[model samples]
Target: MTEVELTMSQRLRCLVIGIPQATFPEGLLRPDEAASIPYAQLAEHLPLPDTLELVVAPLFCDDFDALEIIETLGSAGYRRVLRIVAPKLPNRQIVLRELRSHAVRQGITLEMVEEG
Candidate 1:
């Protein structure tokens, strides 16, 4: 008898963060494109991707959790590109300012994707 080895294939990882109530843009992600996980579970889900996409809600500006998310992802070696999808909001400017600053310090390339 011969022994055979098996391995699991890895899929491209993309992180979408924001309030569940917020609407996600159509065609942002394919039905079978990527695995969806809550922001809270990001850390536990290891082997971070070189590219990451973040969909943030304006409401997140009220807290520091959003910053933490970016920092965490950067520290984990997600340095290729950090795509942010944010819609117009009362605090959109403020939130984006902070996120951009953090991303620069972390050496992560930032790409702001305007909401359609």
Candidate 2:
């Protein structure tokens, strides 16, 4: 697919992490628009895209888990901004602080959006 094939119109490739296909919100994205990879299959999707949109539950993010996610993104070679979509977290400040540092070292700009 990376053979530089010609297309009449531009295509938008969006890869979603930390969300499962079945449980993913319905109206937000169509079946073909994005691929929602569950946590188990995260590292298995090889030839990883340089950019990805992570859809994770903030409640699941603690200091250690957040670090693991950040390291995986770096190892996968995502050198651009990462847009994270999730609901507000009770301990957002603490988690954000931890992630911010690791994200910076990976050359990743973290944009957190409160999902509706």
Best-fitting candidate, scored by TM-score: 2
Residue-by-residue lDDT tens digits, candidate 2, 28-111: 755444565555566556545433344342324333254566677777776665656556789877767767778899877766
TM-score of 2: 0.60
Tens digits of per-residue lDDT for model 1, 54-87: 4242224333354676687667776665666666
**Could you give me the TM-score of model 1 versus the true structure?**
0.57
Candidate 2: give the clashing pairs: none
Models 1 onward score TM values of 0.57, 0.60
Go through the candidates in order and give each one's C-alpha lDDT.
0.53, 0.54
Deviation in Å, model 1, residue 22 alpha carbon: 8.5
Model 2 misplacement above 4 A: 1-12, 21-33, 50-64
